[model samples]
Target: MKSYDDKHIKNIVLVGAPKSGKTTLSETMLFEAGIISKRGTIEEKNTVSDYHEIELERGNSVYATLLHTEWKDYKINIIDTPGLEDFIGEVIAAIRVADTAVVLLNAQYGVEVSTEILWEYIDRYRKPTILAVNQLDTELASFTKAVEDARRAFGNNVTLMQYPVNQGPGFNAIIDLLKMTMYRFPKDGGKPEKLPIPEEEREKAEQLHNELVEKAAENDDTLMELYFEKGSLDEDELREGIQKGMLQHQVFPVFCLSARNNMGSGRLMGFIDNVAPAAIDVPAEHTADGKEVAIDPAGPTGIFVFKTLVEPHIGRLSFFKVIAGEVKAGMELTNFANNTTERISQLFIADGKNRNTADRLRAGDIGCTLKLKNTRTNDTLGDKHFPGPIAALEFPSPKVRVAVEPQNKGDDEKLSEVLAEIHLEDPTLLVEFNRELKQVILHGQGELHLLVTKWRLENIYKMPVVFLPARIPYRETIQKPAQASYRHKKQSGGAGQFGEVYLAIEPWYDGMPPYKDHPVRDSEEITLSWGGKLVFNNCIVGGAIDSRFLPAILKGVMEKMQEGPLTGSYVRDIRVSVYDGKMHPVDSNEISFKIAGMMAFRDAFHQAAPQLLEPVYDLEATAPDTMMGDIMSELQSHRSIITGMDAANGNQVIKARIPQAEIDKLFAALRNVTQGKAKIKAEFADYAPVPADLQKKLSENYKETVAV
Candidate 1:
C-alpha cells in the first residue's frame, strides 16, 4: 500500500433508515473499487459491513463497520453505520468524524421516520452531504416522488444530478446530468459503458443539465458571473462550482442507484472521489477549552479515537483519525484524558473483519491500533509537548430502562464485569446499580437495544440475565408540623442506659426561621446524605442536654430520614428542634441520645401529614399529525399534563410532564400507537406529590414488602 497525502483522502459515512440498503450499497462500492471480488447481500448474511453474529442473526446492522478502498487515485474511507434507532450512537460517532455523509433514501418510501431522525444529526454536524435514492429497480420505486420528498424535507437546495433512464425491472442505465452522458450497465451490473444521451431522452436530460449548472453557479460569485456571460458552465467549471457548493451546503446533489444489482454505483463512486471534501477541507476541530487544532502534517501529533471494538483473542482495537501530523508504528503519544503515555505498537487499516497492516497513518486517514493502556472512545492522543484535548462526542441520553438481574443468583459479580466491558464498547448502554431500589438497572435506546444486550450477555458472557420492571424512585415528605417526645431506658447488666427527648418537627421552607416565637440561637442547617435539607435548632439553654450530645441526636434523626417511617423511601424537606430532654449521668451516652432522637423523630413524622412524591419527567414526542391525537390520548390516560404543542417538519411536537411510573414501557407503547413513526425523549423534571389513593396503595405495598 502507498501512503497518500491529506488531499488524496476522502472520509464518508453511509446513513439512513433501516432496510435503506446501506450495507448493500457499501458492499457494492467495495466490489466496484476492486476491494472485494464479489458483492454480498444482507439476505446471504455475508456482507462485510454487517459481520457480527448478532447482526447476522437479526439481518440488520448493530454496529458501525470501517472499510477503505482506492478509486481513481483517491483513498475513500467508508464508515457503514446502523440505521435502526436503537443503534443511533453508531451513526452519531461516524458523522462526528467524517467530512461527508451519503444519506441513502428508499426510492419507494422516500423520507421515512428514521431518515428524518438521522437528518437532524447530519444538519447538526453540518457535513457536506450527497443524497442517494436507492432500490430504483424495485417494482414500487418512484424516482420523481423520492426527489420531491427529498426537496420537501431538506428544502429546495436538493438538485437532481442523475436519474434512471429506464427504472423498475429494466433499470440498467442512468442519465448523468452533470456530465451530460448516459451510463449503461451490463445485465450482470459491474462496470458501466459511457455513451451519448439517446435522442429521445436528450430533451429532458438537457433541461436537467441546465438546472444543475444553474444550481452550481448560484453558490459562487465568480461562477455566477461566468454563467451569466456564457449562459452555461463548462465541464471543469461545473465540477469546481458543485464541489464548492457542496462544502458550503448550498447545493445537495441527488443521485440514483440500485445497490443490490450494482447498477450506477461506479459513477457514484467517481463523483465522490472527484467531488467529496477531504478531512483537511473540513473546519478545524476545537478543544474543550475552545482551542482550534488544524489538520497539518507538520503540526503536533494528534489522533482522536472515535470508536472502540473488542475483538476476540485480540484485545481492544482503537479506531482513530489522525487530525495533526502523522502517527507511525512505535511512536509514543500522551493520552490527554488520563495523562498517561501509550506506545503505539502497530497500525492497521480495517476492512470489515480483516485488517491490512500499515507502517504509518498520515493526517486525515483512519486506522486502528491494538492494546492501549488508557485510551478509549472520544479520547485524544497527542504529542506530550503539544497536549491539546479535543472535546468528546455528545450522545443522546438513554430513553428506555429495565431492571436486570442474574438468573443464576451467583453470577452477580460476573454480570457487573461483563456490563462494564460492554459499556466500554457502547456508551449508550448505561448500567446503574441503585442501592435504595435494590436493583441493577440497564438503560438503553429501546426494546430491541436491550434485547440485543441480553442476547450478548447470555451468549458471549455465558451468563443468563432477566429483565424486570424497574422500580420508581419515590420520595417521602411531610405537609404539616407536629410535636412528640420519647424516652429510652434500658437497664442491662451493670450501668443503665436512659435518655428522654422532646422535639418539634415542621415542614422546612425557604426563608422560614427555626421557630415562630423563638429567636435564632445556635441553629445548624446541613444537607442530608440522600437529598434535601435538615435544619436542626439547638434551643437547649442552660445545658438541658449537653451540647456535645446535639450531634448524636442529629445523627439519629438523619438515620430515620434515610428510611422514612411511612414508607422505606428517603424523606426530605423537614426541620427538627430539641427544646427539652432528660439524661442520667451514668447512662447519658451517645447510644442513649441516639435512640431517643430516633424514636421521637419517628413519632413526630407519623403525626405530621406525610405524603408520597414520585419523580416526573419532561416528555417530548415527535410524530406525524395523523398519530398525534393517539399519542396525546395515551399520555393523558397515564396522568400526563400536556404543556405545549407545535408543528415542525410536517410533524407534531407534543410536550408534556408525566410520572416516571407511568412510562415504564412508554417507548414500546408509543411505537405501537404510531406504527413506529413516532420518537420520544424524556428527562427528569421534578418530584410531585402522588394522588392520595395511589399514595395509600404504595404505602401498603411497601409495608407488605418490608414485612415479607
Candidate 2:
C-alpha cells in the first residue's frame, strides 16, 4: 500500500438507522474506488464492513470497521458503524475521530428514531457532514419526503446537491446541481453518462442550481463577488466555497443513492474527494490541559488509539489515527498512558480481517498495529520527547444491568479474566463485583448488547454463562424518633464486662438544629460511603460515660449501619445522641461498649418507624409521537412520575422520575413496544421511599434469609 499525506486524506464515518443500507453503501464505495474487485451485500453476509462472526450471524454491522480506498489523489478512510442503538459506543468512537460524517437516511423511513439518536453526537462534535438518502430504488422510496425530513431534522443547511430524476423502480438518473448536468446511469448502475437536463425538469433544475450557487458563494466574499459578476460560479469555484462552508459546519449537502444497485456511490466518492475537509482544514484538537494543538506532519510522532479489537486467535489489534508526523513499521514510541515504550512492529491497512502491510502511515491516516503491551482505547503513543496522551473519550452510562454467573463454579476465575479482556475491547460494557449485593453485575446498553456478550462467552470462550436479574441497592432510614438503652454484662471468671448505653435516635435532614433536647460535649458528622450522612452527638455530663469509649461506640454503630436492621441494606441519614451511659473502668473495655452501642441502636431503630428507600432515576424517552401511548403506559406501569414532555424533530421527549428497580424492565419494554424506535437515557436522581407493600415484602424476604 502507498502512503498518503495528511492533505490527501479524508476520514468519514457511515452513520444511519438499521436497514438504511450503510453496509451496502460502504461496499459500493469500496467497489467504486477499485479497492474491491466485486461488491458484496449484507444478505449474503459477505460485506467487508460486516465481517465479524457475530455480525455474519446477525446480518448487520456490529462493530466499526476501518477500510481505506484511493480516489484520485485522496485516500478515503471509511468507518462503517452499526446503526442499532445497542452498539452506540462504536458509532460514538468513530465519530470522535472522523473528519466527515456521511449520514445515510433510508428513503423508506426518512429520518428514523435511530438516526435522530445518532444526530445528537454528530452535532455535538460539529463534524462536516453530507447526507445521503439511500435505497431510492425501493418501492416505498420517496425522495422528496426524505429531503424534507433531512432539512427539518438536521437544519436548513441541508443543501440539495443532487436529486433522483426518476425514483422507485426505474431510478437511473440524478441531476447534479453544482455541475448543472444530468447523470444517466446504465441499467447495471456504474459510471453514469453525462447529459443535458430534460426539457420537463429543466426549470426546476435551473432554480435549484441557482440556490446551490448562492449557498456555495455565501461562505466567501470573493466567491460572492465572482457569482455576482458572472451570474454563476464554475465547478472549481463552487467546490472551494462548499468546502469552506463544510469546514465551518454551516452546510450539509444532500445526495441521492441506491447503494444496493451501486447507482450513485461513484459520484458520492468524487464529492468526498473533491469537497470534504481534511484534518488540517478542521479545528485544532485540544490537549488534556485545554491547549489547542495543530496537526503537524513535521512536528512530532503522535498516534492515539481509538478502538481495540480482540480476535479469538489473532490477539489484540489496536486501531489508531496518526495525529502528527509519521509512524513507520519497526519504530518504537513511548506509551503516554503508562510511560512504557511499545514497538510499532507490524502496521497494516486493514479492511475487515484482511490486512495490506504498510511501510509507514502519515498524519490524518488511520491503520492498525498488532500486539501492544499496555495500549488500549483512549491511550496515546508518540515520540519520547513529544508531549501527548490526548483527552479521553467520554462514554455514556449503561442503561441495562444483569447479574451474571458461571454455570460451573470452578470457572469463576476464568470468567473474570475473559470479562476483563472484553471490557478492554469495549469500555461501554461495565463489570463490577458488588460486595453488598453478592452478585457479579454486568451493565450494558440494552438486552441485545448483553446477549451478544453471552454469545461470545458461550461460542468463543467456550464457557457456559447464566444471567439473572440484578439486585437493587436499596437503603434504610428512619421516619421518626425513639429512645432505647442496653446493658452488656459478660462474666468470664477472670474479668467481667459491664457497660450500659442510653441513646436517642432521630431521622436526620439537611439544615436541622443540633438536638436541642440534649446538651452536647462534642459532635461528629460522618459521611457514609453508601450515599448518605451519619451524625453522632455526645451529651454525657458529669462523667456519666468516659469520652474514650465514644470511638468504640461509634464503630459498633457503623457496623450495624452497614447492615441495616430492616432489610440488611445500608442505613443512611440518621443521628444518634448518646446522652447517658455507664461504664466500669476495668470491666468495661471497648468490646463491652461496642456491644452495648450496637444493641441499643438496633433496639431503638426497630421502634423509630424505619423506612426503606430505593434509588430514583431521571429518565428521558424519545420516540415518535405515534408511540406516545405505549411509552406512557410502560412508564405508568413502573410507577413512574411523568414530569414533563416536549417535542424533538417531530418525536416526543417524555421526561419522568422512575425507580431504579423499574429501569431495567423499562428498557426492554420500551424497545419491544416501539419496535426499537425509542431512545432513552437515565441518570440517578435522589433516593425516595419505597412503597409500603414493597417494603413489607422486602423485609419478609430479608427475615427468611436471616433465619436460613
Candidate 1 C-alpha lDDT tens digits along 253-364: 8999999899978888898888888888878888878888877777888999999887667889999999889999999999988999999999999989988999998889
lDDT (C-alpha) at residue 464 in model 2: 96
> Which regions of candidate 2 deviate over 4 angstroms?
none
What are the candidates' C-alpha RMSDs? 2.1, 1.5
- How do the residues 76-116 of candidate 2 rate in per-residue lDDT, one tens digit apiece? 99999999999999999999899999999999899988898
Model 2 score (lDDT): 0.92
TM-score of each: 0.95, 0.97
* Candidate 1: clashing pairs of residues: none
Best by TM-score: 2
Best by lDDT: 2
For candidate 2, the per-residue lDDT at 9 reads 92
Give the C-alpha miss distance for residue 244 in model 2, angstroms: 0.7
Instruction: Give per-residue lDDT, candidate 1, residue 66.
Output: 96
Count backbone clashes in candidate 2.
Answer: 0
